[model samples]
Target: MKILDKYILKTFVITFTSVFVILFFIFILQTVWLFISELAGKDLDFILVIKFLMFAMPRIIPLVLPLSVLLASIMSFGDFAENYEFAAMKSAGISLQRTMKFLTFFILILSLGAFIFANNVIPYAEFKFINFRKDIAQMKPAMAIAEGQFSDVGSYNIKVDKKSGENGNFLTGITIHKKSNNFDGSKNVIKAKNGELISNEKSNILKLVLNDGYYYEDIIPKKYEERNKIPFAKSSFKKYIIYIDLSKLNNTNNEDYTISNTNSMLNISELKYTIDSLENNRKKDIISFVDNSYQRTVTQGSLSSNKALNDSIITTKIKNPDLLSNFIPKEQSEILQIANNSIINTNYTIDSTEQELESKTKVINSHWIALYDKFVIAFACILMFFIGAPLGAIIRKGGLGLPIVFAVLIFIIYHFVNTFGKKIAQEDGLTPFLGCWMATFILTPIACLLTYRATNDIGFINMDVVLLPFQKLFKKIFPSQNQ
Candidate 1:
C-alpha cells in the first residue's frame, strides 16, 4: 500500500473500531434494557441474559457497521480537516476527489461486509437469538421455582419448602397443586416428602423426581341429591417422574422464515414451492370464481324459463278450464316448483363459493405484498450507507455525542416512515416495495444534496448559529436564563 493509503486505512480502521466498540456497547445496553423490561416481574436466568447478548452480536453488527463507517469517515476526515492534513495533501497536488477515492473504496468494502453480515451472519444470529429466547421462556418453570415461593409452572402451582444445590442438581421439598378446569372444575393437591429437579440435557426434560407423595383431589358434585365429599387418593411412591414438557426446545427448520428481503436464508426450494403454491391457489380461485359465475348464470336462466312455463300454463288454465287438465298435470306442476327451488339453491351455493374465492384472492395478494416488502428491507441497508455517509460529511461533527445523536435520529425517522409506509402498503392498497423503501427513496436525494453541499463547501443550516441569538436574547430577557 502507498504511504497515503496506509495512513487513510490506519485512521479509518482506528476510527471504525473505536466507533464500533462504542456503538456495540450502546446496542448491548439498549438490548439489556429492553430484555429487562420484557422480563420484569418474572424470574430470568442471568446466564441466558449473557447468552442473549452473545446471540445478538451478529444482528447488532449489521446495524453498527453502516453507522460506524459513517462516523469513522466523518471523524477521520474531520480530524484531517481540523489538523490541516487535507490542506497538506492538497498542497502536495492531491485533489479532494482523489483523497475521497480511498474513503470510497473503504466504504465499498464496508458495504460488502454489511451485505455479508446481513445476508449470512445476521440471519443465523437472529435464528439462534429467537431460539435462545424460546429456550429461556421454556426454562421459565425452573427459573420461577425459587426457594420458599409458589411458582406456577404450566398446569401446576409448585412451592419448594427448601432448596439446595447438590452435585449439579437442585434438591428441594416440593409441594404441587395441580388444577384441571377440564374435569368439571376440580383441584388436585399433591404433597411430597421430598423431590429433586433432575434435568436430562440430552432429552431436554426437567424431571421433578418425587419421593413418597399423596394426591388429594377436590371434585364438585354434579347434583345436590348426590353425596359431594370427594375422596382424596393417597399413594406412596419410591420415585415419581413428573416430566416437564420441553418440546419447545426442539429445533425445527422454519422453511418459510424470511429475514430482511433475501430468500437465500430460507430454503430456496421452499420459497419457490411457496410461490408456485400461491400461483396455483390463485389460478384455482380464479377458475372457481368463473365456474361458480357460469353455474349461477345457468341456474338463473333455468329458473326464469321454468317460471315462464308456469306462468303460461296458469294463463292457459284461466283461458280454458276444460283444457287445464290436458295442459299441465298436478304432479308435473309440483315437479316444476321443485326444479325451480333446486336451481335457486344451486345459485346460492355458487354465490357462497364466489365469495370464498374472492376472499382467497385477497389473501394471496397479501402474501405477495409481504414477500415484496421483505425484499425492499434487505436492499435498504445499502441505501442506508449512502444516506449515512453523506449526512455525516455534511454535519462535520465526529464526536460520540453529535454523531450518535445524528445517527439515532436519522434511524428513528427512517424507521418510523418505513414502518408507516409498510402498514399503509399492507392495509391500504399501496405499492408494497415502494411503501417499504419510501424513506430511503425520499432521503437519497437529500443525501445527494448534502454530499453536493459538503463537497462544494455550500453552507447548510447551522443549528448552533440559529440557536445562538435565542440563547443571547433569552439571557437578556430573563436574568434567570443564565442561572
Candidate 2:
C-alpha cells in the first residue's frame, strides 16, 4: 500500500469511529427517552435497566451506522479538499477514483457486515428486547400497573390513582377492566376505593386485594331489541380479590420463543416462512368463506324455486310485480322476515371477512417489508458513503460546521422518505419491494450526479443551470443595455 492510500484510509477510519460513537450514543439516549415511561416510576434494579438498554442498542444500528458513514465521509474528504491535499495528489496524477479505491473496498466490506448484522443481530436483539420488556413486568409487578393509567396485564387493564408502599404495593382509586375473551371490548369493570398488591418472589401469581369495591358486568342480550336496555349486574363488595397470572409473561428461555409472532422479532428466513403460511391461510380462508356464503345464500332448491316463480310470472299477461302474492299471508310474512335476517347476517359476515382479510394482508406486507429492510440497511451504507464522499469533495469544507449541516439535511431526507415508504407499504398502499427501496432509488441518482461532478471537478450545484433561465427572462423583459 502506498503512503497516500494508508493516510486516506487512516483518516477515514478515525473520523468514522468518532462519528459512529457519538451518533450511537445520541441514539441510545433517544431510545431511553422513547421508552422512559417503562423505566420511570418503576422501581427497577440497575442491572435490569442495563440489560434493557443492551438488548435495545443493536436495533439502532441501521439508523446510526449509515449516518455515521455519511458524516465521516463528508468530514474526512472535505478536510482533504479544504487543505489542498487533493490538489497535491491530483498534480501527482492521483485521480479521485484512485484515491477512493481503498475506502470503497472498505465500504463494500462494511455493507456486507451491515447485512449480516441486520439479518442476525438485530432480530435477536429485538426478540430479547421484547421478552425482556415483558419479563420486567413479571419481575416487578408494580411495573405492570402504572399509576393513573391503564396497564394491560394478562386479561385485565389495571389503573391506580396512586401507589404508596415501599415496593409501591398499596394502591388507591384502583380500577380494573377485564378484557373479553372474544375481542368484544371490556364489558366488566371493577372499581375500588383502595387496593393492596400481594406477591411472592417465587410464585407466578400477583394478588390484588380490593376494599369497598363494586363489580359491574354488562350482560349482553341475545335479542337485538333488548340490547338497547343495557341490562347489567352491579354488586357492591366489602372486599374482593383478583389473581393475575405472570407465568407466561417471562418465557424468554422457552424454545417456542423462537417463533415470536412480531415481524421485527423474526429473521429473513423465519419471516419468509411466516409470510408464506399467512398468505396460504388467507387464501384458504377466502375460499372457505366463499363456499360457505354460496351454500347459505344460493342453494339449488332456491334456484329452482326462483326459476319456477319467474316462469309463472312470465306466463301471465301482466307479470305480478308482487312476488310474495303467490304465497299464503303467514308464509309471506315468514319469508320476508327470514330474508331480512339472512341479508343482515350476510352483510355482517362480509364485513367481518373483509376486515379479517385486510388485517392478515397488512401483517403479510409487514413481514415482506421486514425482510427487505435487511438488504436496505446494507445498501444504505454504500449509498450514504458515495453521497457524502462526493458531496464533501465538492463542498471543500471540513470540521463540524458545514459538513454537519449537509449531513443532517441529507440524512433527515433519507430517514423521512424511508419511514414514509415503510408506512405506505405496511398499509398496503404500495408493494413491499418498492416501499423498502423507495429511499434508495430516490437517492441513488443524486449520488451518481454528485460523484460525476466531483470526478470532473464541477461544483456541487451549477449556478448557471438554475439562474440562466431567470437571467434570460429578465433580459427579455427589461431589454438590457448590452442587448
lDDT of each: 0.63, 0.89
Local lDDT at 171 for model 1: 43
Residues 360-438 of candidate 2: C-alpha lDDT, one tens digit per residue? 9999999999999999999999999999999999999999999999999999999999999999999999999999999
lDDT value, residue 192 of candidate 1: 81
Give the per-residue lDDT digits (tens) of candidate 1, residues 259-343.
Answer: 3432323332444566678669878877887897688666554354456565654555445555435445763566557667877
Model 2 root mean square deviation, Cα atoms: 5.3
User: lDDT, candidate 1, residue 311?
Assistant: 68
Task: Name model 2 segments beyond 4 Å from true.
Answer: 141-198, 207-242, 250-259, 293-297, 300-349, 464-483
Alpha carbon lDDT of residue 183, candidate 1? 43
Candidate 1 residue pairs in backbone clash? 261-374
Q: Per-prediction TM-score, please?
A: 0.65, 0.80
User: Which numbered prediction scores highest in lDDT against the true structure?
Assistant: 2
